[model samples]
Target: MTSFILFAALLIVAVIAILLPPLLRAPKPSTGADHREANLAIFRDQLAELERERENGSLALADFEQAQNELQRRLLDEVQPAASAPSETRPGRKTALALLVVLPLAAAGGYALLGNQQALDPLQRQARITPQQIEGMVAGLVEKLKENPDDSKGWLMLARSYKVLERFPQAAEAYGRAGALVDQNPELLADYAEVLSRSQGGDLQGKPTELVERALKIDPNEPQALLLAGAAASDRQQFALAADYWARLLAQIEPGSEEAKALAAAVERARAIAAQGAAAAPAGQTAVANGSAVSGEVTLSGEVAGQASPDDVLFVFARPDEGPRMPLAATRARVGDLPLRFRFDDSMALAGGKKLSDFKTVSIEARVAKAGKAQSSSGDLFGTLSGVKPGSQGLRLLIDQVQP
Candidate 1:
């Protein structure tokens, strides 16, 4: 409708231009001195000629009449004035001035009615930075934080950057400081756990695990919490737990996305680990496999952390300190402040093909940290295989001063 109005207005202006010129008639011309002089000059010349002819006795009545008529015709021709000079260049040039005023106003009014101001806005036209560019920016922020640690926001950005870099420990430390600065945010806590796990030498057995659990408690459905929980569970051989965590995380992950694909792979890994444990059961030995609990007899023959003497505390508690306390899974003859060979002699209670009895698996961390928390939070299994496994020989692990 507005377009039609504008078009009609322009058409009206055009019709005015086409129709107005003829209606606005020019003023009538008045006789001036030049016109009178021109007429009188022709009349005088004819009269003077007639008088001279009469004096010379050559004038006749018919000749006089014809001569007078010729004189009148000459006078009329002489007095025919030129058309009056135009008052202005192209009559009524003021119309053009009116046009000049009207065109801009029309344009402005049209814009007010029809134009999309958002499209014309400079900010709206500005180009957006790509995700890769943003990631790069985060990286630079991290570098700046490394140089100048005082900037809290920069540290947070750096922490996020480290997460992108997969440098978990550094990310955790940065995130921890960020958390301290901003008062225990759930996201920061989650990032802290994630990085701390890798920081403690790729094992979530230490500082990272606790943070993850605490973070989860704060926010149950936190994406980071789910991801980290899955990782921690798998590390501890809690395959079913790992599967559940990852499956929950998959729901949060964008469908058919790279993160979803990665989580899916983790889920499959958990399933495989669970299947291996399930398949380890013997056909007729289900009673023994299902019935026998691990009898942890782990004997630490080494110096316990913060203890006054080797005899201060019994070896049984500290030797298989990390995982589930199975009575048959204890260590023996572990020397003080020395490398101890922890044996897994669960043959008495653990029948063949029973849990962990058949598999030659990885060593459980029986070593104690300075804080007396088990180095491995869950009890570490003896090996990483499924077979009729004997106790690990020449087993050695170093115990450093664990951070508080």
Candidate 2:
């Protein structure tokens, strides 16, 4: 406010400085100095002509004198006394003063009508809106949305704001509105799916999962959709599918982001679970192919063994040594079962016609998670051995590396 007042004062002063001279200047005097000066010039010229006439004998000395006296009399008659000369009429000072007043007022009125005064205020737009004020604003928007249901972008923004505030139900409603307006928009679909999941206690199996799938169909690499899809698959115990979805998401995300790091662990854990499921074949199925069976025992390192609880999950798996490093076979056991024996063969394959025997060389890995979840999180212990040939016998795996 103080700054504004100062600016206004300075502006008025500058306007006055520019206009005052023309408005308040003293009227100049209208003297007869021009008339008196003209008469004196005529008299001098007449005297010069008279002297020339006498020298040329065009007139006698007496005639030149007489002409000079006549010229003097004429000059006296033309010249007026300064005290009796009339002063020219000066323009009214009142008009100039009126112009001075009108110009500033017009300028000020024009600015008031057309200038954006709010732009000069640094906090006028958003900075002054506090959290509580924001909530009120959101409420106002909600009311507006109720009145006008066709504002798609408004609904989207409202949904996002509600999501930030953890008002999942309201967010879901707004997201629905936005999604309805722009079907097949990947970001909207994914956000709507996520909000719907949250509103329903984080259950992604039904409509939420369907929404994510739809979003992915529109944009195969949409990161949020891929993540939700992976989570949904994991919830359904389709660990391989979950891993594949997360891997695609990981490739598109910033590699150094916290999300990517967490996701990398998730992919690893999924592969481990998938491997385990494959290796532990359904009842009545033939044991994994014997031709390429890899048998190994996982033991916890003494240095980190104390961190595990009996209920903690342990994952052991084998992946391709060369290309498309998805797990071929895997199995899970409790940490209490560490130093336990495990085997991988065709029965443990992720899908039919794919098995440990498909690759001559393979990599083996083991991870221990305290949460008992398949996806690895922070503090999980893991270790790996690369370039191992299939059917290797009596191999010993150690769980040593710690996920940071």
Best by lDDT: 2
Question: What is the alpha-carbon RMSD of candidate 1 to the true structure?
Answer: 21.9
lDDT of 2 by residue, 82-186 (tens): 545457333556666666688668766887899887866767745665779879889999899889888998998899899988999999988888846547698
Off by over 4 Å in 2: 1-128, 283-404
The digit string of per-residue lDDT tens for model 1 on 116-221 reads: 7665566776887776886788767767766887887777877777777676767777776674653456677776776777677777766676777666556645
Give RMSD (Å) of candidate 2 vs. truth.
14.2
**lDDT score for candidate 2 against the true structure:** 0.77
lDDT (CA) per prediction: 0.55, 0.77
Model 2 weakest 10-residue run by lDDT: 345-354
- State TM-scores per candidate: 0.37, 0.42
Model 1: residues with Cα > 4 Å off, grouped in runs: 1-158, 161-170, 179-183, 198-202, 254-262, 281-404
lDDT of 1: 0.55
